[model samples]
Target: MGKPAPRSFAPSPFRVYNPPMSDANPLTRRESEILDLLAEGLSNDEIAYQLGISPNTVKVHVRNIFEKMEVQSRTEATMEALRRGWIRVPGIEAPQVEASAEPLSWPPLESGWRSWQLLVLLAVFVGVSLFVFWPYRSISVKVAGAPAFTTDSGSAVGVVTPRQDAPRWSQRAAMPTARSRAGGAQIDGRLYVVGEIATGDTAALEMYDPNLDVWQRLPERPVAARGVGAAAVDGKLYAAGGCAGESAITNVDRYNPGAQMWSSVAPLPEARCGLALVALDGRLYALGGWDGGDVTDTLFIFNPEQDRWEEGRRLPEPRAFLGGVSFLGQIYALGGHDGVKQRSEVWVYDPADDAWTPAPSLPESRSGVAAAAEGVSIYAIGGGQGEQPPLHERFDTLTRTWSTIDSPRTGPWRHAVAVVIGPNLYVVGGWGGDYLANNEAYQASHLLFLPLGAQGLQ
Candidate 1:
């Protein structure tokens, strides 16, 4: 017993680490799953889609994983996991050294080379180098918000990078009737456009099928109005207040795609036009707009069950021609015009709290902008003054930050209607210069990672 008490407790220079069990691990089961996906370089939205959860939920898990591992970024967490032998990445093999009794050997070169032979070898090396670098020297990519690229020849030239995750825009079938300031809604994988300018045919309703890449005329609304607010709730499309001719009107209409018909619903309490409408938690929200004389901060909630419009909390400021959408479970109001000038303000309204809180502002003032939500990102496209490049920006709900994306149109694309169907964003006709018949389709940016497992092997 005395000899056992005198035993040494010194550390071992050569030690091995064994990963802990699930119960002893810092992360939970769900967190571990998220960490594995993060190692694959999947974005929050992509991870949420794969897990069949909301992006907000994915974000929460990511934050928890960071806290548990005491790591700041995904790369750090992944490296830490590798160091602890907690996870294994596919297709990464260690170099193998075969055991051998003989000494290492190298190929023997000629004792001496002639000057002509050396010159020939040098010329071959230069040829191979130029051949390898020719393509890269001839190609360049102009990233969004990057400085202008100019060659010494003073000519503009670029090459398209073969990147799957890069944001790109493509042309779609042009609208039959070119118009601006129209109301748009999407239902059952189809986009619906209603009410163009009052000067022309205001009650023009059309439906676009992304699968077919075609547009079909639908039954017109009962009231001929323009600058209306439209949304779809519970599979039914609701079109609200807009201008008929010279003034705003309180006309609410509901369209059923299954029946291909339109029916009148309870109109708004007051007349307004150029408003922003969105559906949240089974109800319709009509945000700020012009009420004939001036811009208003009105927030009207429409109850389909009761068929009534209830006044909710007003906005922080009065604005018209704004962009609004129901992201996560809250209502977001983007930039709009307030009587005299365009605004860069952004506000979020939580239904549970019944209050409006200001979020991050846009990069520049915009009006008549179109906003749509896909996964964890909100796209604000087509607005702002001047003949500058089209202002196409994306807002990350998880990070609460905004970033610019590429746009097809070089000039302004205001008063356009945008809808997200599948992975493509369909932007219908708008007033780019005169009435534009442009049907620009934009593919949202995805974060492409190094393919893992079998894909990596392929």
Candidate 2:
């Protein structure tokens, strides 16, 4: 390799987003674990003891963490981690002190004191000490069921019944190619996956048939890119704005299944990747993304009839790798990263008013998530790392609340795409330490299974 050309601007210190940690977070799994311990006021030796590692190794990890996070001390690192939603502190209430009739004071013992008087004095002293300290006993009482470290999505406890409408996931046929940052679109009961971080085939394209549980390759994408945003409209799949190598690109390519050809459309006003593309009312809306150097708040809309991209209202907060979906004639942009931290804020865009409004925030903060709407609910899947793994959250539009849903994978699941077909929500390829070929299907409807004896009786 040759020396690379110099950049026009200085890169951000938090830009080392790659392998093992996904694209948003910068720390490794072990480093993140150590950081969590540091935030809990643990010394290096204590952290080493907890992780079953040498104290010197823990010190080295802490040094690397400091360098990566650009912090000089543990306090700064803890604050940065907390700001990024990388670690959560449980509700640790402080012990309250009560007022006494007299100030805590003691008079010097008189030299003429007798032996009986001295014994009485010692007994009184012991009683006073117990009375003063008794109220603080509850301070050491740990929060029951609270894990040493966990995400905002409260830790799971004793057995609980699953909701009838809760989404349940099951593994299906894996993709032929294992890759991360792939984009997906659902058309005609088939899901089309395009672009990802593969060895030499970033533009790899394949389609999955749910009923048959089979995958077949289609014509590959002409533009080699990952972190692309895709949506199906009018029987055609549109993939737009993703990182082509190290730089973000504005290329908008459309694929016609009937013709089996790819063609270019009007490019975006600016180059960006990790944005969200969703079709609402026959038009494609490109939401927030990262524009090479910084997270973008820009929104662009593409009209097929005009074959041009138009700039729309700026996002309430700039973000990338967010989950966007059209539900009940409105666009909902879910949790995403804003360069520094993962966001839990949910925003709803009204096409009629051309304005964005706040909605109920997600139960947990994440980015690179897959969002799909089924019936009256929207599912936000995966996109977590650090002290936490990717998880699922469901938004009940009718109730205007968010709740946790069951997920198949308990590890990092960022950069995946989701699409709903009938009663099932399918989450496609994403990164989990390494590139994944997982094709997991989540059933949104209630299902019942009969016992073997009951089946024989029937």
Candidate 3:
């Protein structure tokens, strides 16, 4: 038999006194404990571990502490805690200041030397101002452009030789066929887009020549697929693992810009579509893909030397249509549709230890984002819930902050990808309202705008 239920009782309600101009019962006992930990410089995760609580719970408590304390951040909360006598240092001393405290005073100096001292101080101030405010201009680099190409809801193609001082956009040559969900990469000196599945013809490999303002139809892809992922290694282009007909395919194909030929490499171990490919060092990493049934976080690593695929660590969440880029020899995966809704998680993979770390998350939730990483900054451009405004965000590895860039004339582009060469980025075809033939190039300082010199399109 089960134990009998206990009876509940009502107690008298008592008012908890608080300081003037403060909330009654300033903070709860748990919040006070959290504030004490904050004063000790404990992070949310660290506090969670010490208190044997979930990190999410710790986060909630910390947030509550800030509210009751009328503080913005941990530092502010610690300062307030000290003021309220909620926390104290063991050895160090802190002097409290009143709201209406007077400023410090200095004794008067002798009148004789005061004027001379004032003159000397004025001269020093002028010299310092001159040194700090010297006027000079930065030389802007020249970016050569041909005709511009744009997708639907975007501008028409033209030349975009923008001033390095300010961002500018120009149209470029459009694709012969308007399609979306194509995979693109930079190999040699040209941009290649594989599998235009929107036309129901998933066998095309299209090449764009930025210097010549032209589009050339290369040989068709070996497999009929769309939303395939492509990567470049040693000037060679690779396309693999995409949606074919009713399901994802496992075929991997390699294209030689020098030989103008296509060859089949080892296929992927699993079938996946809407996946992303990133090349680091000499190896390629395939991350988070969709396989009709549900999204997956499976990661695959391919070794060119061995010509085979090896499994790697899985993602923290199941997602697809996300963006992946290799930067500083590390792989970063960001923003995807987790089958239910859009995700903003940013997961980083370090090949050295083969472990994953959480960097800063994306500013907003999105999917079908195209990504490109050069040096320390990674760019996530286009892609949203459906078609909205053109959104571009840059993540700086050094500062770990995300900054928004000027939007493209094109409004709401999805199923597109970006490739870096030198300081320029070519964002190719995607579905906006219809199959888009638009291809636009972004030119900014220190951007990966490497030209396809000897590897120029034939």
Instruction: List TM-scores for all candidates, in order.
Output: 0.61, 0.62, 0.61
The regions of model 2 sitting more than 4 angstroms off are 1-167, 447-458
In model 3, where do residues sit more than 4 Å from their true spots? 1-166, 446-458
Global lDDT for candidate 3?
Answer: 0.68
Q: The CA-based lDDT of model 2 is what?
A: 0.71
Error of 1 at 352 (Å): 0.6
Tens-digit lDDT track of model 1 for 1-458:
11111112122111222345732567777887777755543445445645766656987898898888888776577667655655543333223446588866644446566678889977975566445422222112121221111000111111101112334777776665556678898999898888763124367788888888777878889987767899999998999988765577899999988898999999999998889999998999999988877889999999999999999999999998899988889999999988778899999999898899999999998788899987778989977654534688999877889998876765566778988876677888665544444577777634333345321110
Looking at model 2, which ten-residue stretch has the lowest summed lDDT? 150-159
lDDT of 3 at 38: 51
Model 2 over residues 1-458: C-alpha lDDT tens digits?
33223212112112111233432677888898787655543444345545767656987898899889888776577657655556543331223346578866545556577778989977975566345432222112222332211111112211111112333668787676655567888999999999763232267788999989888878878898877889999999999988765578999999999998999999988998888999998999999888877888988999999998888888999988899999889999999888888888999999888899999998888887889887678889888654357778888888898888876765566767789876678987765644456678887744234346332110
Worst lDDT window (10 residues) for model 1?
A: 146-155
Residue 230 of model 3, lDDT score: 89
Better of 2 and 3 by TM-score: 2
Go through the candidates in order and give each one's C-alpha lDDT.
0.71, 0.71, 0.68
lDDT of 1: 0.71
